[model samples]
Target chain A: MILTVTPNAALDVTWTVDRLVPRASHRVDQVRERAGGKGINVSRVLASLGHATAVTGLAGGPTGRLIRADLRAAGLRDELVPVSGDSRRTLTVVSREDGDATVLNPAGPRIGPAEWDAFTAHYARLARGADVVVLSGSLPPGLGPGTYAELVRTAAAAGARTVVDTSGPPLLAALDARPDVVKPNAAELAAVTGHDDAHRAAAELRERGAGAVVASLGPDGLLAHTPDGVWRAVPPRPLSGNPTGAGDACVAALAAGLAAGAPWHRTLCEAVALSAAAVVAPVAGDVDASVHRRFRTTVTLVPLEEPDAPHVH
Target chain B: MILTVTPNAALDVTWTVDRLVPRASHRVDQVRERAGGKGINVSRVLASLGHATAVTGLAGGPTGRLIRADLRAAGLRDELVPVSGDSRRTLTVVSREDGDATVLNPAGPRIGPAEWDAFTAHYARLARGADVVVLSGSLPPGLGPGTYAELVRTAAAAGARTVVDTSGPPLLAALDARPDVVKPNAAELAAVTGHDDAHRAAAELRERGAGAVVASLGPDGLLAHTPDGVWRAVPPRPLSGNPTGAGDACVAALAAGLAAGAPWHRTLCEAVALSAAAVVAPVAGDVDASVHRRFRTTVTLVPLEEPDAPHVH
Candidate 1:
């Protein structure tokens, strides 16, 4: 089973208003809440794809209880360690008029040293049974930048392929553990490697010991630099809706592909198709089933000899 | 002791952002949450003033748990009845630059018949020991408009002085139950009695069997129509800040006064002063202690000769 870890999980609340007027009271038209964090999103996508997946993370207080209840209701396997601080909430205000979403994210509950030790110990046991381990999202406060690095090393020692999706210092630090895959969006890639070009940034991550790099290019699709070859995959047409969890869906595809020992080209195609389908879904961490099925046949993947080139057809 | 009942309680969450731009993501600078509802707000203020207060209401789910935990942490006596539906949340987004707040209030958890029965039974038991009972805020779904009337009647039967703070039909109906005092803001007064004049509206309410009518005139302070006499109280000068909970603070003062058997004029004076102090405070249900003390000495109260006559300063 694939194991996903989200250190900073949250209770995501979505409020819909007729029109968002600054500094005015709004009679919310609707409210929707869900369990959310990068790894939790990834695990949800994998479970939808019929993949056996389990999620591990730190949770606490009432918000944490709500998250746990949601996970249970969704039938997603979870092993969340308790913390002293209350978990945070992420608010997304959706404008009913234009469907534009505004997000407000707060830093999550702090994880103490003792909590960190407990998490690491629990993860080591889970990692041994995990076929593929995916570490995603920001590190909660009280933990140093090397937290993901230590987790990656632990997974590696357990002989499980690891995929880490994060940004900046934590992503850079985790590279030394030689995770099987690292997924970064165009902006995150530039932020870490100081390269505006996705190809060069992926190459930089690879040089720092990432087994492969799958860089997401938003609506443009996925670009990969794997051991077998370099590949670029694009959807047949641009899909429009909420793009909040599209990248997480792509990571889920990549992790599933790696676990199933699928060929790189087929994996890239699946990642591109699923992410495109995800864009049309109403909320994050979910996809329209019919859209996903249709995109599978329409997405195009082109194998490239060199990384620094782009071809769209 | 004062007994406050909030049929529709909520976990109030506040987020502070640099600016509020519709359809744009906001990086929240800070977050603050508290247990809130109109009656709960009154109870909080009473607790701050060293008054013995107990809050009873219906709560369920994780949000309810958070509210209970906050009340416990604050050392407020509570007797919250459990329900099946989850209690709701109210979001207030405060703009850091302008200090303006935008609120989103959802209808709270639906209370089943069983839950409603359970709550009223618990309230009756508590009302026996209460000197003053407050029925405040909106009624959740699964209850009729006459819910507040029933509660007011119950408190009256127990010989507890009753204060009903609500609007529209609920307030109009509770007046028939002969509550000791009914606090309605200027707009609510106009809506119920079809009188633009606060004095006329308050007199109309007293004519309908209400023992007293304490009409909150916003920045102009309060206009009271009691058997003893008519009195109008205003601050020395208009205080400007957040006015969201000023009315609730006024209710707290009125409740405290009734519990202590204070004279009507003194009660109106305290209500006006405390409410003005609440206007300058950043949050609802709280007052600046120094501001409260200053206003206590500066607020001016006038004994009105007639109900329809206008008085400004």
Candidate 2:
């Protein structure tokens, strides 16, 4: 089983309007809400792919209840811990006219110190029964930057491989715990390593103690720097749609591959295909199954020289 | 006691951002939420003025729970009827840079026939103990245009004077029930009566069966057409802030006047002052008490020839 953790899960609300005019009143034609966060999205993708995935995270208040209810309705395993503050929400206003989306994200609820301690203990217990533990998304307020590092260490101690998908300080800090894998998109990789090149950034993250580094380059596809080899996997073709949850789809495929002890080349291929498939779907946490199936066999994988290895002529 | 009914009550959520750029993501700096609707605003104003006001209407689901909780926290009486459908929310995105607000309003829950029947029975019981019943705002989906008319008749049967504050078909329909007062803002009056002139539009509403008509004209104050006389009340000077709840404040004062059997002149003066005070405040259902007091004695009232009376000059 794979366990995914989203520290700051959200109730994602999407409102469709005839047209979006800034600073003007709009009558929403439709409203769609669902439980959302990086780890939850990863878990959702895994579930859709017939993987045994369980979600555990911190949630609270009325919004938290709604998130939990949605999780139950979606038939995803829920092990979210309770907090006192209301969970946050992300409102995406989609214009039916131009298909433009305006997103409003609230900083999630402040998690108390006791709540963090409770979550760590809960995560440790859950990790023991999991082959891989995926720690994803932003840390809520009152949580330290080293939050994922602590969870990564906990998972390691529980004899589970840990996949950390985050950015900035959390991603950098998680490297110290030597997580099995750290998946950062091109932008996220550069933000942490200060390297615009995905190859250098992934190598830098690996040197910082990450067991493996997978950098998702949107549309361009996946760059992997693992102990086995360095590989770049490109999608069969550019799929144009919403790119919101494409990274989560990549993480889902990576975690699945790790759980099955697959080779880096096969893992990167699947990750690239799934990410492209997610982009083909309109909403996050969903994939076009046919797109996934078609791209899976056609994704091109190219072996590359390891950045840190000694020069060979 | 004044009872205000908001059939389509909302949990108004305000998100403040540094700047609003269309089709771009915004990180909300502040989030504020409160129970809101025309009738709820009226009740809130009355409560703030040390009047006994109870909120009664149809509310359901999570948003309704939040509204009820807020009402309880505000120490106002809550007699809201519950339905199965989720209550709607209105999101206002305020840009701090220019102080521009973008509002997104959802068409509220569809009330089942059984729910409407339940609410009417509930309202009838609540109206019996009220001196005045104020029905305000839009009717939820699945409710007819005669919703307010039915409520007005029910209030009358319970010996309660009714103030209907709405527009279009609902406003026209409520008039046939002979409500004690129907308050429409300039635009609302124009929409319903097809008269650009506030004076003529208000008089037309009275001619249609309303016992009285008070048309709020924003910075210009109010125009009252009642059995006693026709009068235009203007504030001392234009004071502007937020005009969102000014009409509700006007209705609040009107309901207070009717409950106390105050004369039309005094009622119109108070209504104008309170409405301006609401404009001075930043939020709806709130008033700057000092502004209200200052404007009360300063409002200028002018008597006009009754529109429907025979000319004797």
Candidate 3:
């Protein structure tokens, strides 16, 4: 079973309009709502791909209830610790005509120290049964920047491989805990690696003690830095449409490949294909099994040079 | 004493930022929240201008608590009857360079029938002791379009003069109850009167049986159809800047003048001057007394041709 943690979950509301003219009112033609958080998205995608995934984190209020319902709808097991503050709503004004998404996200509910403790205690018990633990998204208000690092340490101590998908302070802090895997987009990798180029950014993350770093480059596809080699898996074709859940889909595929005992090259290949399939798919973080099989056939993973055993230096 | 009803008041949040680019993140520089509702604004301005104003309506939940706190901070007297649902929040994204306000208002809390009964009881009691009553803004969920009409009838039956400031079906329904006054901006007035132009709109409202119809024309100033005469008052200068609360300011000045037993000219002049002053003021619904005095020098009130019996065909 896989365990995923999302500290700051949200009720994602999408309002689609033909055009968004600032300061002018437009009647929203379409609206879709889902319980969302990075880790939850990854877990749902994994579940859709036939992986047993359990989600644990803080959730409460009406929005929290909706999140749980979404988890159930996605067929993912969820355990939520009740919180006092209302869940945050993230509004996405999707301009379909222009293919733009304007996000208005509220600062999520403030989680107290006690709530964090409760989550950690629950996670510890759940982590004991987990094969791989994924900690994703930003730390909600009141949590220290090092909260993800602490969770990474906890999961590692429980003898489970930990994967962290986050950026900024949490990403920087999690580096010290040295998770087995970390996925940051090219931009996040650049910031973390303190490098301008994607290649150097990937190399820098590995040097900072990430067992492996996956830098997702849009259209250019996945660039994986493993001990064996740096494999750049470009997509079969340049994909179009929604790119919202592409990374989460990649994370799900990578986790699935690792659990299935596929080699690093094979895992990276599947991840690229899964992400591409996700982009063209109607629902985010989901890929048809048949489409997954078809695309897996076309994914080509080519390896690059790894510096040395001192890839760290 | 003037009683203003804000059945569904909100904490209006205005986020001032640069251009809103979809899918791209923005750094919000300033966030301003205030007690908001057309009636709340009118009562606040009335209080600031030294008029005795009392506000009554429903408020509940955490957001409702904040609304009440803001009202107190603004030094406005309000009797917010507690209810179960969370009070609404209206988000206005204002552009820094351009004078544009993009509003995203939540459909307000659902008020049970019991809450409605309680409100009417208190409103009637409040009406009996007030110089005039102003029923404004929309009714919350679970109430019909005629909710404002019902309140107007109740206030009028209690021998209180009332002004209905609303639009759409509610405005039409309130007209049936024949409130002493109805204040709708040009667009709302046009919808109610089936007359898109200001002159025709005012005439149409009066014909439908409104004792006095006050039409707010932004920048162009205020127009009125009263028992004494037909009048139009233009601002001293072309009004520029924020127009968010200009209409409410007009209504508040109208209500205040009526309370003072001011004649048609004085009331129209005050309304037009204060309405213009509101645009020049830093905030909405607030006309600086100094600015009011300055603008008062220029507002020209003209008497239009009055209809015999003031009844429409």
Candidate 4:
């Protein structure tokens, strides 16, 4: 079984309005809701791909119960740790006139130390029964920044492979634990490695103790950095769909690649292909059957040695 | 007992954003939920005022359950008639820049004829025990236009003073039923009366067979006409607080006034005072005790006949 953790979970709400002006009212034509969190998205894709995934996180109030019910209805397994405050609800108002979306995301409930201890202990025990563990999303309120790294350390001791996908301070902390793999977007990699160039970004991220680095380059494709060198995996085309959970597809692909025992070269190629397939699909993180099968054929893999002067990311 | 009927209640979700634009994702600074509907607001106020009030409405799905749970938590007596579809959620986005609010109200769950029949029977029985009955709000989807009017007829037949607060065609339907009273805003009054002038509007609404017509004139207070004569109940001050449910506050005052056996002269004055108090209160339908008490004394009840048509809303 694969385990996924989302420190802060949310009921994501989106509305489509004609236009949004300051201090003005807009009639929203459409509204949509989904059980949301980076780890939840990844686990959903994993389930759709025929993998058994167990999700654990903090949830509370009526909104928390709703979120847990949604996850169960979607056929995803969960162990929700209830808290006192309501889980956050994020709003995305899409303006049709301007072709842009304004997002209003509530900061999730503040989790106290006792709650953190409960989750950490429960997750560590749960990890003992899992082959792989995924520590995803931002740190919930009241928890220390090094929370992910501690979880990785605990899971590693339990003989489970850990994969970390996050950004900023949390990602920086997770690097010290040397998770088997770290998947960061181009921007996230740049922020962490302090490199504008993708080639150097991958190299610097790998040097920060990530056993391997898989940098998602949006339309360009994927960059992989290992002990041997660097490799670029190019997809057939750019994904064009609602850009909400595509990154989770990359994370799912990376986990699946690791599970398949493929070589780094082959794994990175499959990750890029799957991510591209998800982007072109209607819903975020959705991989069409035909595209998934066809993408396996066209993904291009190019390998290179680590440069003598490791490029500054 | 003041029984308030909210046929299609909502879980009102309010979000505060810097600005609103269509098709754009906005970062909501704050998100909160409360049970809402015209009659629901009136019931909340009545409950606050220490009046015995029972709210009946359709509620379903997880959201519907939350609505009932919240109403109970707020110490409001409610008995929901469960239905098939999910209860609706109303999203009110407050953008600070323009001081305007955009409302995305869900077309609430479709109400089948069976639900309607069940509610009417349930409500008619409840009405026999009530001193006043308020049938409020617009028609939800799958409901016929004259639903409120039918509810009004049922309440009146049960010997309860019936008050209808709705607009457009539904308002027209209730008028033909000759409800005890109809509270229409200036615009709704104009639509019902076929006249833009406040006095003419009141006459037209009264001609439609309502026992009394109270045409709200916003900051100017109310233009009221009863069997006795026309009168104006003027507010002591024009307040700046949000007036989302001020009209409902007036209707609630009307019910409480009628229950207290106040004559039209005093009922109209009390309604004006409650509305002005609502305007001055920070939250919707919240009539400040001090403000409400103070305004009760300042509301001028000027008889239309004695004034000689000089001026007054």
Candidate 5:
């Protein structure tokens, strides 16, 4: 079973409009809502893939109740800690004319010291039987950058493999805890290591104690630096739909592969195929199974020779 | 005591930002939420003014729960009927740079036929002790234009005064029910009557069986055509801050006056003064007591003779 933590969960609402005009009233044609956050997205994909995934995080107020109900209705196991403040909502305006997505995200509710303690206590108990633990998304206000670092250490202490997917100071801070895998998109990798090259940045992150580094390069595909070898995987062709959940799908594949003790190169192939499939689906954390099947055999994984990498530090 | 009915109640959310740019992400500086709708706003003001106001409407799901919780926290009386669908949310983006408010209003949840019957049953029970019943805001989907008309007839049958504040077909339909009062802002009056002249349009509405017509003329203040007489009330000067709740405040005053059996001219003056004070406050249904007191004495109410109306229908 995989345990996923989303400290700053959101009730994601998507409004479909014919066109988006600033400062003008829009008559939304359709509205779609789901429980969402990085770790929640990861758990949703894992659950859909027939994996037993339990979600634990902080939720509160009406929005929190809605999130919990959605989880239960979807038959995904969850143990969300209650907090005082209302959970945040993330709004996405999907233009029906051009299919462009404009997102408005709230910073989410603040977590008090007591609430943080409560979450950690609950997390400790839930982490006990988890095969792998994934900590994802932004930290709600009041939690320090080291919050994920501490959680990663706790999971590691319990002999569980850990994957961290976050950016900025929190991502930088969590690297010191030596998570089994750290997934950073190209932009996030550049922002953190001050290196425009994915290989160089991944190497730097690995030096800071990441066991393996997977860098998502959007349309360019997936690049991974593991203890066994460095590999790159790309889809047969670029598939276009909505790229919102592609990266999380990649993380889902990586987590699933680690749990199954799959070979690193095979894991890279699965991650690339799953992410490409996700881009063809409308919502995040969802993949077209048929597309995944086609891409699984079509995606190519090529191992990189260490001496040929000029950007490697 | 005043009873306010809001079938399309909403969870109103306000997000404050430095500036608003279309298609660009914004970091909201502040967020405020409250239960809101025209009747709800009227009830809120009536409660603040020490009037006993009981609210009855259709509420359901998580958003409805939050609205009820907020009303309870504010010490307002409510008996909202439950439905299967969730209540809607209305968002207001207040740009602090120029204090401009951009509003996004949803059509609200669809009220099934069963839900509508459930609401009418609850409303009839609550209307028994009410001095006045105010039907306000838009009708949700699945409710006909005659919903307010039916409610007005029910309230009148219960020996309670009826006030309808809405526009278009619904307003036109309810006037035939001979509601004690009907209030429409200038735009709504123009839309329904095709007349830009407030007095003429209001007189026409009164002729159509509305016992009284109170037309809000924006900065021009309030104009009324009633069985007692014709009256116009204006503040000493144009007071502006946030005009979101000014009309609701006017409705609050009208409900209060009808419950007290005050003179029509005095009711017009009070409505104008309260509305002016409401405009100077940040949130709807809230008034600066000192501002209200000053405006109450200074707002000029003059009787308009029937012959002085050049555009009389």
Candidate 6:
């Protein structure tokens, strides 16, 4: 079983307006809302692929109740811990005229120290029954930068492989815990490693302590630097659609591969295919199944020579 | 006691961003939410003025729960009827750079036939204990244009005077109910009567069936057409702040005057003063008490010789 954790879960609300005019009033006729966060999206993709997954995270107040209700409606296992503050919400306004989108993200609820302790204990208990634990998304207020590092250590102690998908200080801090795999999109990788080149950034992340590094280069595909070897997997073709959840789809495939102890080549291929399929899906946390199937076999994997420095210890 | 009915109650959410750039993502750090709607705002102002007030309307789902909670926190009476659909939310994004605001309003939840029946029954019961029943704001889906008319008739049968503040077809339909007072701002009055002149529009509204008409002309002040006489009440000077709830404040003062059987001159003076105070308040439903006190004795009241032909029955 794979356990996913989203510290700052959100009730994502999308509004469709005839046209978006800044500083003007809009009457929105269509609205769509769903439970969303990086880890939840990853778990949704994993569940769609027939993987056994349970989601555990911090949720509270009325918005939290709605999030839990949505998760239940989606048939996902809920092991969420409760807090006192209302959860955050993300509003995405899409323009019908030009297909433009404006996103407003509020900083999530502040987590009390006691709430963090309670969540840590809850995560440890859930980790005990999981073969793989995936920690994703931003840390809400009141949480330290080393939050993921502590969770990774808890998962390691519970004898589970941990996949960390976060950026900045959290990602950099999680490295010392030696997570089984770390997946950062190209921008995230550069932000943390200060290297614009995906190859150097992935190598730097691996040298810093990650057992494996997978950097997702949107449209360009996946770059992997693992103990087994270095390889780049490109999609069969560029797809045109929403790219919101493509990264989560990539993490889902990576977690699945890690759980099954698949080789780098096979894992990278699955990640590339699933990510491509997600782009063609209408909403986040969904994939075009036919596209996934077709692209799975056609994904081109090219092996690359190891970096000159060979920084791996 | 004054009872205000807001059929389409909302949880108004405000976010303050450094700047607003269309088609870009914004990280909002400050968020403020309150129970809001035209009727609710009226009730809030009335309550703040030491008037006995209660809010009765249709509210449901998670958003409704928040609305109820906020009303409770504000120390106002809550008589909201429940429905199955989630209540709507209005988002106002304010740019700190230029203080420009972008508003997004969603049509409120659709009320089922049974829910409307229940609300009608609930309102009738509340109206019986009230000296004034105020009907305000838009009608949600599943409600007809005659919704306010039906409520006005119900209030009359319960021996309660009604003050209606609404626009368009709803305003037109409510006129024949012979509400004690109908308040429409300059734009709303123009839209319903097709008269650009406020004096002509108010006279037309009174002629159509309103016992009295009070038209709020922003900055210019209040115009009242009533059985007693025609008068214009202007503030001592222009004050600037937020004008969002000024009309609601005007309605609150009108309802207070009706409940106390105050003469038209005194009522118009109070209405003009309160509206000006509301404009200077930082948020809707709030009044700068000092400003209200200062303006109350300073408002200029000019008697307009009846429009060539008197239209009052």
Please name the candidate that would achieve the greatest lDDT relative to the true structure.
6
Docking class for candidate 3: acceptable
Clashing pairs in 3: A101-B23
Q: Tens-digit lDDT track for model 5 on B1-313?
A: 7999998888898888777665566666688989988888899889989999988888887888888988898888978898888888887877789887766677778889888888888899889999999999998788999989999999999999999999999999998899999999999998999978777788889889899899998877988888888888888998776665899999999989899999887888899899988998899878889888988888888888763446454
Q: TM-score for candidate 4, please give it.
A: 0.89
Would you list the C-alpha lDDT of every candidate in the order shown? 0.88, 0.91, 0.80, 0.80, 0.87, 0.92
Tens digits of per-residue lDDT for model 6, A154-229: 9999999999999999999999999999999888998998978778888889999999999888898989999999
Tell me the tens digit of each residue's lDDT in model 4 across A199-291: 777767677788888888887788888654588888787766655566788888778767666677777776776776677764454677677
Query: Could you give candidate 1's per-residue lDDT for residues B126-242 as a string of tens digits?
Result: 999999999899888888888888988899889899999999998988888889999999999999999787787788999998998898888888898987898888888887776
User: Which residue runs does candidate 2 get wrong by more than 4 Å?
Assistant: A306-313, B306-313
lDDT of 5 by residue, A282-310 (tens): 89878889988988888888788653456
Clashes of each: 0, 0, 1, 34, 0, 0
Rank order by TM-score, top first?
2, 6, 1, 5, 4, 3
Two-chain DockQ for model 4: 0.41
Where model 1 places Cα greater than 4 Å from the true spot, the runs are: A303-313, B305-313
User: Residue A303 in candidate 3 has what lDDT?
Assistant: 68
Real contacts recovered, all predictions = 0.73, 0.88, 0.36, 0.59, 0.26, 0.88
- Candidate achieving the largest DockQ: 2
Q: Identify the superior model by TM-score, candidate 4 or candidate 6.
A: 6
Model 2, A120-211: lDDT tens per residue?
Answer: 88888999999999999988899989999999999999999999999899988999999999998888988998878778778888989999
**Candidate 6: regions farther than 4 A off:** A306-313, B305-313
lDDT score at residue A146, model 5, on the 0-100 scale: 96
Relative to the unseen true structure, what is the Cα RMSD of model 1?
Answer: 2.7
True contacts kept of 4: 0.59
Q: Among all windows of ten consecutive residues in candidate 5 chain B, which has the lowest summed lDDT?
A: B304-313
Model 2: which residue pairs collide? none
